[model samples]
Target: MTNNMTLGQRFLANEWSALAVAILVGLVVLASMSPAFLTEFNLYVMLRSFCVVLIVAFAQMLTLAVGHMNLSVGALGGLVAIAVGGMMEKWGFPVPVAVLAGLAIGAAGGLINGLLTVRTGINGFIITLATASAFTGINLGITESIPFYNLPAGFVAFGTGRLYALPYLLLPPVLIALALAFFLARTVPGRQLLAVGGNPHAAELSGIPRDRVIVMAHTLSGLLAGAAAILAVAQLGSAQPSIGVDWLLMSFAAPIIGGAALTGGHISVAATALAVVLIVIIQNGMVLAKVDPYWVQFLLGALILAAVGLNRLRAVRAGGA
Candidate 1:
C-alpha cells in the first residue's frame, strides 16, 4: 500500500523507507546465506566500515541535487586522510589541528571544482574528471608512495570507540550529514542552491545568483568530504593514501541507485543514508557468502544498469501517459 503512494508523498513521509526496506531485505538474505551474519559484532563492523562511504555519498549527493558531480571526491578524501596521518606522525600536531588541515584541503578542493565549472563553462563530467586526475596527483605528491601512520590519541577515539553499543565514531558523519540535510531542506541559501542546480538558467533569471550557489554547493561538498577523511583516519588508526579511491564509484552509486537523479533538482539526505547502507549490506553479504570482490563489482554494475533502464522507461511511460 505504501509503495503505491505517489513518490512525492512517499518522499515527504519517509525519504529513506525504500532504502531501509532494501537494506533489511539484504540483511535477511545474507543472514539466511550464513548463520554468522546476525551477531552484534558483525553489525558493528559493518556500520563502522560503512561510515566513510556514507559520508562521501552524502557529499556527492549534494552536488547531484544541483546538477553537478564531484569526481575528485575520492581522491580529495584520500589526500586529506593521508594529510591528517602525516601531520600527526611528523609534526605531532593535535588531532584538532590535523583535522582542520584536512578540512581546509577539502574546502579548497571543492572551491577549485566550483571555479572550474563556472569559469570554464565546461560540463561537470569534464571538469570533475580532470580535477580527479589533479587530486590523485596531489595525493602522490604528498605521500610519495609511502603511507603515514600513528595518528594522535584523540583521532583514534572517534573511530575505534563504541558508544552505548554504537560506534562512537559514527557521531561525526551522522551529525554532519544530518546538519547538511537540514540546511538544504530548511535554509534560504540551501533552497537557492537547490534552485540553481535544478534549473540554473531559470534561477539566474529569477535573481538567485546561480554562480554563487554553485561555489557554495561545491564548497559544502568539499567540507563534507574533508570531514569524511578525518573519520576515515580516526577509524583506521592510520592515514592510508588509498583509503577513499573505491569511494568515487560507491559514493555516487548510493544516491543515484537509491532514488536521486543525475540531472539535479532532487535531494534526499535520509534516503541517501539508507542507500549507502544497502550497498554496505550487499558487500557484506558477498563477503559472508564467500563471493569474489570481482563479482561484487559486476553485480553493482548490473544493478546500476537495471536501475537506469527502469528509470528511463518510467520517464518515457510517464511522458506518454
Candidate 2:
C-alpha cells in the first residue's frame, strides 16, 4: 500500500502525464463538438501549425532548463528568417547552403547572448530583451517591412506536401523531439545543463563548468530558434518580417504548461510538444465553433495563469509531503 501510494504521488507530480491527459481530453471534446475537427484537411492544418511552435517551445525550454529565459526568441527567429530568405532570394543561394548559414547565424546570435549575460553578470532576460530589439531593428532595416516571396519550388513543395492526414513538415519536429529527449535524458552534457539549472551552487561544487553550461544552453536555444525560422519560412512559403512576432507567448506558454520549471532545472520535451498540440486544438476549435478571434488571446492568457497556479499548488503539495 505504501509503495502504491508513493507511485501515485510520483505520477501526479509528473508533468507529462498531466499534459497527455489534457491532450486526450481536448481531442475528445473537440471531435465531439465539431464534425470537421477530425477531417483530413483540418488535421493537416493543425499538424502543420504544430511544427514551428514545437521547435520554438524547445528553444525557450532549453533556456528555462538553464535557469534563464530568452525573451528574444521571436526576434531572433525573425532575423534568421530574413537572413535565410535574403540569401535565397537575392544571393540566389541554394537551399542547403542557405539553411546551413541560417543555423550558423542562429548559433552566433545565441553565443552573443550567452557571453553578454555571463560576462556582464546581468540577467539573461535583460540581455535577450536588448538583443531582441537589435535583431528586430536589423530585420526591419534590411527588409523595410517587406517579405521574400520567391522560394525554391522544392522547399515550398515540402512545406505543403502531406501524406494522408500527416504533413511532411511534421517529420522535422518529430525527429527533433526524439533527438532532444535523448540529449536531455541520455547525455552527460544534457544532465549537466539540468544540474546547473536545478542547483547552481551544487553544480559548481561538483566540478561542472556552470558558466559554460549556461552559455551552451543559450547557444542551443538560438540554434533551435533559427531552425524554427527556416521551417516558418517554408510553411508560409515566404519570409515575413513578422514571422516570429507572436512566438514569444507561445514559446513560454507551451513549456510552462508542459511542466517546465520557471525556476529552472526541469522540463519535458514530450510534454511541451503535447502542450503545443493542446494550444493548436484550442485555436482550431475556436475557428470551428465560430468563437471570436480576439477571444483566443484571452484564452491563451487564462491557460497560462491556470498552469502557473497549478504548478504552485503542486509545489506546495510536494513540500507538505
Candidate 3:
C-alpha cells in the first residue's frame, strides 16, 4: 500500500503541500501586482507581524490539542502585557525580571483556568469564557484603560531590528516552533497530551492521567500567551491595553487553517507556521492594494468559515477512504 502512491498523489495527500502551493502563488501574484510587495522593508514588516501571531496561535493550538478551547487567550495576554509593563516602569524592574514575572503571571492564570475546569467538571469553553471576562476586568482595573509608555530602549530596538528582510523578532517564534514540534513528536508528556485529546476513556484506561494532561495544555497555552504579549509590547515600543484585543480571530484561524483537528489529538507546527505565512501574505497584499482595513477583518471571518468547511470535507473523505 505504501509503495503504490505516485509522487504527485503523495504531494497532494500531504496536508501542508496545498498551503505551500497557495503561498507560492500568493507571493508571485502579490509581487507582480505591487512592486513594493517584495521590497526589503515591506518584507521585514510582514515578518515582524508574523512573530506574535504565531505564538498566539500556538497558545490556542495547545488547548485545542486536548479538545478544549481558550476564550481567555487574548484577555490573559492583555493582562500580562500591562502587568509586565507596570513591573518595568513602576517598580523599576529590569527586562529579564519583568519578562520572567510576566510569564509566571500567565502560567498562574492558566493554572486557575485548568483547575477550575478540572475540579468543577465544567466545559472548558464555559470555563475559559468566564475567565476571559474576569481577566479583562482585571486588566481594566489595573491600568484604568491606560497604556504604558517608556519601555527600555534596548528592548524596543530588538523588536524593530532586522537583517535585510529578516526580523530579529522572528527568532523566538522559530525556536519555539521547533521546540514545540519536538515536544509533540518525541516527548512523553507531549504524546500523552495528544492521547488524552484523541480518546479520554482509552487514555485513562492506559493510565495516562487525562486530567493532568488537560491542565498541562492550559498552562502551556497561558505561557505562550505571555510570550506573545511580551513580543507585542516590544514591537509597539509600549504596552497598550489593547494589545491582545483582536487576537481571538487570528489565534483560531491559523491552527485551523493549518489542519489542526478541533476534535483534538492532531496538529502540525510546520503547517501552522505556513498558515501564518499565508495569512500574512493576504494581509500584506490587501494593504498594497489599498483595501480598507475593515475588509481585512471581514475576510478573516470568511476565511475561518471556509477553513472549517474544508476541514469537514477532508475529514469526510478521509473517513470514507
Candidate No. with top lDDT: 2
lDDT of 2 by residue, 1-321 (tens): 224447767777767777777788989999998899999999999999999999999999999998899998899999999999999999999999999999999988999999999999999989999999999999999999999999899988999999999999999989999999999999999999999999999999999999999999999999999999999999999999999999999999999998888889999888898889899988998999999999889999999998888788778767777
Per-residue lDDT tens digits of candidate 3, residues 150-243?
8888888988899999999999999999999999999999999999999989999999999999999999999999999999999999999888
Off by over 4 Å in 1: 1-18, 317-321
Candidate 2: the clashing residue pairs are none
Candidate 1 C-alpha lDDT tens digits along 149-240: 66666667767888544798777778887787789889999899889878888999999988788888888888888888888888888888
TM-score for all models, in order of appearance: 0.91, 0.97, 0.97
Candidate 1, residue 95: Cα displacement in angstroms equals: 0.6
Give the worst 10-residue stretch by lDDT in candidate 3: 1-10
Q: What TM-score number comes out for model 1?
A: 0.91
On a 0 to 1 TM-score scale, where does candidate 2 land against the true structure? Answer: 0.97
Question: Which one wins by lDDT: 1 or 2?
Answer: 2
lDDT of 1 at 126: 87
